[model samples]
Target chain A: MSFPYSEKVMEYFSHPKNVGEIEDADAVATEGSPACGDMVKLYLKINPETKSIEDIKFKSYGCASNIATASIITELSKNKTIEEAKKLTWKKASETLGGLPPAKVHCAVLAVDALRTAIENYEHKMGLLKEKKSTDTNIIEKRLKRVINPLTGLEVLKVNFVKKIDLDDGIITITVNLDSDHPFANNIREEIVERLEPLWDIKKVYVIFNDENERH
Target chain B: MEKRNVYLDNNATTRTDERVVEHMNHYHLNDYAVASSQFSHTPGIKAKDGIEKARQIIAEKISALNNEIVFTSGSAESNNLALKGIALANRAAKRNRIVVSKIEHFSVLDSAKRLGKEGYDIAFVDVDGEGFIDIDHLKNLVNDETLLVSIIHGNHEIGTVQDLHSISEIVHKKGAYFHTDATYSFLQIPVDVKKYGIDLMTVSSDKIHGPKGVGALYVSEDVIIEKITDGGFQEFNLRGGTENVSGIAGFGKACEIFSEEDVERIKYLRNDLYEQFKSGLKGVQLNGSSDFSRRIPNNLNLSFDYIEGESVVLHLDMRGISVITGSACFSRALQASHILLAMGFSHERAHGSIRFSPSKYTLKEDIDYTVHHVKEVVTKLRKLSPLVEQQ
Candidate 1:
């Protein structure tokens, strides 16, 4: 009867809030190490003019402590201004959840990292714009990085976020960086292709990962 | 809170059987005495008799001579005695190597590691995915310089039983003594010291519903073991401590509870439940052997993909069913099951492993309830899992 979790942590785990992806989020970030077997993808729809978190959601693949921390983070950060959300610490998030077990504090740390990352992405995107002008090819890399390949746990830069970054007159060709014997090599390629294919008016978005000839 | 309790964690420990309890209570109430003071008083004489009778019962169970059994604290201590005691006792010019299998319990592994630092060369033989030792590889490792080869009789995580008959033979052929930690597999399967030709073995009392503090190490006549602890002239001067009179009495009583028919009944129920879980759930893979004859009767280790094993354990606990996981997060070091990893399981699959062990007292309805709960828990957890649908 003495579970290590608080009632609040268990509640959030059993019935997580704001789950799943936001198909076209203004900012997105993934946190946690796949090697540790805990990962979180935080997708946020921001109020552009107000610079506030509007709608928030999460997709977490981890233990109960991890999922609960992710769910609680979304609940505590939604509708907050960027400054306020970034100020939130892992300690505060754990206290808000009534407290996690001593061994599970890393889960809270991951939640805060994801939130801070999302806001930073928003700020970076906002910096490039007067407002809402994301038709740039470089913006494509940021968006594709949002798709956290479960295995590598790396985003755009580590896993072929644009291996060469070539931009022709209209064609924007990008290659995915994948491991040779990766089990989800196909899904990673498809996700990158699916995300970039709908951006701007690019004539073509070619998908490639772990290209053998290029892998010297 | 009002729901019925379901305890299927017999491999970890079990409720002390009522018969064992009665013997323990009797000895605790009346027979408590200094067994070494047998020349002094009546209580001392009675205590000495109780210790001897208990020793005789354990000796008969394993078909070993009464003098060959040295009672220690538990299987962990017995392993220490068998490995280190033998090593220190036989610390000679030539014999200075140790070999243990990868799938041995932590006690055997840790003890062998301790010997390694003291100048003994240590090597581990690999196991197949099902946890069977690679026999040819083992044969190649053991040489005349090899001091002792210790392996588990049955893996506590995967329930894969190592064939002591062949393993002991290999060690003996190389002139190295063999020790098997039979803590988990002792009474659950058929064990005979002579039939397997084991030079040494460790058996636990608590594992068979006896008292926890009493365990015995079966050291053959030829193996000279040095004292791990010293003081008194007890346990043939090898283990120097006063006997745990009540626990030893209970240990002997627990030894008489097992029969071939009882083991068959346990196997039938374990196999039946394994079938139910496999048939009822998707991606529900049994970790060890499916063939009933190859593994222990009351043990089943299974893994469900796309989720962590700790969550399943918590979910089952919430429903009043007790279980354990082999995942590293659940382990002492927060490391995943070395057994599963050594058997070639991916880290993800290793974290997803669960061990279900039921004693002879487990009812059919208890098994059914556990299975139904496991299916429900796995489905619910999958819905919360991020990796299940992504890949």
Candidate 2:
């Protein structure tokens, strides 16, 4: 049977680059969860003087697309300034690998998330990050944009599943336009909670379904 | 020489036997008339004879009467027919409940779900860790109001073989018709429908090295089942369609060509492959029954720790070995195998599960090659896995 992978994806997956831990790393961050069947941990050793990434490595516990995406993202960010690496997008990483399957585009997102989080960690350590305000709707929406609908391979917000977002007394309630019985409903909800729960000021995160489409 | 391709996914589908193919060529080329035309022309008579001969062979294999076998497209249709047909026929008989195991093929499970949507009380019986149906739970669920209790004889993924005799006994005691999807166990294990007290059995030819698109459902003569498909009278009026004469002939030829010796040899290879993995790898767990006799002879499912199964599957594919994984990443639904999850495995365990099913055509060299490449792939992936601790 034919595999649903591009030749570049297979090439990187079969022989992935930067597949290890950076033992005395400047910054490290992990994204995704084992329960979701995809996780990537990125390690960066940045040059403090020039603010450039001296070396970058990654370890993945996921499928070929996850490994391939992580490999491509590390290749794209090595030796670049931390600011430049932070500017790298998941779409660019996936495009460099000749584009992933629609179902696997989320792996690219996870890779980019891990890389940016590691850069953020480095910035926080160097006191380069600004004093952040308390969590707000815009920050919640920015994080929610990372939550992908598995069926559509796009952000839940972009797919118009986020019907409403309400933040009150540190409690975030997001209403999605899907029934609980939809095949990917639980996945979307779990991802939303996973994304919003880690905010510094968030107290509780609740995801409610609109039950508007229960065809599944 | 080019690297040899080793296929260990026989549980998915087998390579059709050459002898069966040669036998089918005659019906496809010469006697290409529909069996319904038996009263019309000479070729039609030959086609009818060919189909009847196939029916007789399949019936004899399961120790059923020739008239009891109804041909369907394959096991999925057979399962759909058995569940929906019995539910429809017994709609007015005061039995509105259907009980099935949680680990049944989607054909059985989804059909029962459809029946539930139509107002039938559907109950899913649980399975133990080894994928065996819980006997006491089944007994509790299947009562007088239950029209059918459908379970799989041999689980397709994990390879656990259920005790049909005791299951049938329980269902019969409750006055419920017992149906089994024996697609994986039809030829691999001996099944006597009469001895097991099975009312309906679904068997597919493709799993037994026969041509695809042909399967038979054995319905006991006393069971009442309505036709789900409406068409011209065919398959004893229980199923309506033009017969697949060539595929049926090929299926019969496959059954005739099946030898017990091949099963014994494939079992040996399967066991040897597992033994090699146990000796060569660390943190490898067997997912199915520990008892060899209770599992499908040609099936072995293993979960390698730390590393995900899809990576191993792709790496093995690069080395020309074919296998399947239960990882959510590998499925379009983005969910792990329901069978493994229903067995109470963690998502990590389910993501690491791999199924290797060797057929009679698999060789010792193939097993050795697979084990070696699998070890290399697992070791490499484990090093790159965030779940694995750095030493």
Candidate 3:
């Protein structure tokens, strides 16, 4: 059966691009999955002044796509700046190789993660976090906030540690902010009551804290 | 952009064959009525006809009577039914011990374990380094309380063939039932149900070029089988629910093809490939029985010692040569292969094991290419190993 891969990717893998090692590599990264008997090692050299990749090579230890993905990543990364290299994703690599089936798609993602992680290691050594940033955190925060506290039926605005009642037992009761005047506050109180039902045996836990303890 | 996929995971699950697909499609399209429907019964009648045809063909292949075969989803279901069904059905008599081999598939092993939870005593028969079961040990393990003797016809990991005839005789002498999960080596070998005296046997379609999610259980006419699934009386009130007509028909077609011409032809190709591999490769050790008669024709399990099976398989996959690793990587599934471990191989050797199973469609050139790549890849991967250096 014909597998999804570009002529270039297939050719490079058949006669793998940079088949062996770089004796004195600028950066070398190895990722291993002991379960699947898959291991991948990447070697790269970057012109630190320009931050553009010079030489990129890899040795892959998994499936056909693993080699193709690793080889493609190296070829694609060569001549690209470190900042540009980190932006490389599995979707783009797979798209570059035509495409991978749903199951083998994980192989491409693994290759990309290995490449970016290798680049990150190099950057950490050089003490450089790329100035480029993503807006994902904003969207993620919004999505995570949707998970309301089932106990108090409230949006957990913040969590502050109340003083421990007993050191040996690791027990503490903290105050949670629920809108007292809200119409559903009675329902929220009932919800808290229901939540604490199983935990009721430890009866000392009450929701009250000093105003000074609410500092961020 | 044009892309082609070469799937090598046939042992895991095969691509449904063209003829089987056609048969199934016909049943699903033209014969869409439920087999149980009282009103609008043409489709129902066709479905029943298709099922009966499947059952008859399956029965003939295994040398079983038509009434002896019960349809199931797959080997897992069939195995569970054979083990648990027999146990539960005979529970009233309070016969509650199961004797099985360690080299049996996870389906059989897990089912046995589940039965243990239900207060059944379970004893395991172990295999040697060559994956052969100790028949004497199996004989010693059987006692009066033993309810069933479950052994696999073949080992899935190391391609080990068990002496089913000997096992059957021993179990029968003890007055306990013998069941074999024949899914691994049934179609590959001549499965003489009478010769082995198998009280219960399970066979799956996908393993032998049929559809997945379809299999059959061979119950001897004399062996009283109790129902497992409690519902409608579809499969003679033994296994309940509406029939998968398409799957059953496809399974029947696969069984027919298996019993006819595919057997000798596939075996020839498999032997040729093995001969080429044995001659071409050095430092390669076959894990199971080296004798062709003692093993499955198409399955070649080997421990490359220095090179990891995952590395070899992955390299082959990249080259569009599909193969399977007998061991699981740490980050992969939890089951790394209990069969290989049970066969006295070290953890390192187990992880270095690979299984090469050729189908009826596997051509000579494909095997040659595989051999060539096996030589090259094993050489390359061994260089990355300290074990090779030490050796």
Candidate 4:
């Protein structure tokens, strides 16, 4: 079978750079999870004086695209200042790897999410950022933004699948515009729940699909 | 000669045997007339003879009557025809309930699903951890209302060979027709329809080193089934289309050339490869039945801890090895093997599972090379895996 991976993707997958842990890393963060089919952990050694990333490494438990995307994300962010690294979007990492298949675009998103989380962790460690309340809607929205609609290679929120998000009594109810019988509804629902269920305050996560007639 | 590519994905499709190809060439070039024109001309009679000879060869392999065989495109079409045909034909009998094992191939499972959409009651029986059909669960599912039960004879992914005699007994006790997709275990495992009490069976050519685009469905003479496709009076008027004469001839030749010795050798190679992996690698677990007698000889599925399967498959591909994985990332649907999941394996186990099926053409040297490279690849990938603990 023909794999849709680009030449650059195959190159990075074959010989990924910075593939290990920084034992004395200033910050470390993991995004995605084993249950989600892909997980990436990023380690950052930040230069305290310059606020720049001194070294970066990654370890991945995922497919070729996942490894390749993480490799490129590290390559794009190394030695850059924290503010500059924050601007390193998943699209840029994907472009540097010649672009990923639509189904694999989430791997790029996951890599960028891990890198940004590491940066945020470093900033938090340095007392530069305040600890936001865990139950904030902003946190919910940000997590949902990483929940990709596999069919469109876009976030559920951006695709307008999230018709409504209700948080009450520690239970989060997400209403998606997709029909219950839609081919990808179950997958999207599972991903949404996986994204939200791990919250520090979430007691239960419920994903409701809008009726097919009301989908439009 | 130095070996270049090592192919261990024989369960998917084998390299068409050279002898089978030569046998097919004679029918394609010399006896090119339509088999349906047997009543009108000499070439037509020759074509008809070729078709009948092939039917006899395939039928004899399974110990079924020559007239019971209906040729189709492949296992998928055979399965579709068997499930839909039996269900539709038996509608008047008020037997609207159809049962199938959870681990059946997509063709059978999806056809049952379509039947479900059409208002037929479909029940999926579960399988055990080693991929054996849950006999007790199957007994509970089949009853007077059940029309047919379709289960896979040899699982394609994990290599579990079901006890056909026992499964058939259970289905028949409840007056349901038994059908099995025997694509993987056709000649490698002995199947006697009469002895096993099977009413229908699906067999494919490509899996047995025959030409692609050819397979046969074995229907018992007493079993009534309707044609799903509308066409001319072909395939006992149960399936309609111009016959694939050359492909059928090749399929027959492939069956005729089946050797028990080759199966034994392939089994040995498969076991040897597994033994090498067991000794050479760490964190390796066999996915299917440990007993060789209970599994297809050529198939070996192993799950490596801490690393995902697609990464291992891709790395092997680079080293001229061909294999397949049960990982969601490897499939178009982005779903892990339902069979593995149904067997109660964790998603991690399914994602890490890789299947290696050696054919008669596989050599000991190739297995050695594969094991050597697999060790290196798994070691490298393990190092890069976050799941693996840092030393």
Kindly list the per-residue Cα lDDT of model 3 for residues B1-391, writing each as its tens digit: 1222445455666667788888889988998667654454676887788889999988888788999999999899999899988987888876778998998877898989998998899999977778788877887899888889999887666666788888888898879999998887877777889977999999999988899899989999889878889888878778888888888999999877665366666678667766776787766677888776888766778777555675577567766788777655422453456777777665445667777877777766777777777788888766543233223
- Shares of reference contacts reproduced by the candidates, in order, are 0.25, 0.71, 0.20, 0.64
Cα lDDT of model 4 by residue, B281-388, tens digit: 989999988888989988999999878888999999988999999998999999888998899887778888999999999999998889888999999999998777
The digit string of per-residue lDDT tens for model 4 on A25-79 reads 8887777656556889888999989998999999998999999999998889999
Q: What DockQ results do all the predictions give, each relative to the true complex?
A: 0.32, 0.33, 0.09, 0.30
Q: Report the C-alpha displacement of residue B384, candidate 2, in angstroms.
A: 0.8
What is the TM-score of candidate 3? 0.66
Docking class of predicted structure 3: incorrect
Place model 1 in a CAPRI quality band: acceptable
Tens digits of lDDT, candidate 3, A138-207: 4223322322332222243333222222211222233445444433233333323222321212232233
lDDT values of the candidates? Answer: 0.80, 0.88, 0.70, 0.87
Q: What is chain B's TM-score across the candidates, in the order shown?
A: 0.97, 0.99, 0.93, 0.98
Error of 2 at B200 (Å): 0.3
Off by over 4 Å in 1: A1-3, A33-35, A121-216
lDDT per residue (tens digit) for residues B202-298 in model 1: 9999888888888999999978889898988888998877888888888888887756777887888888888898789988788876566878777
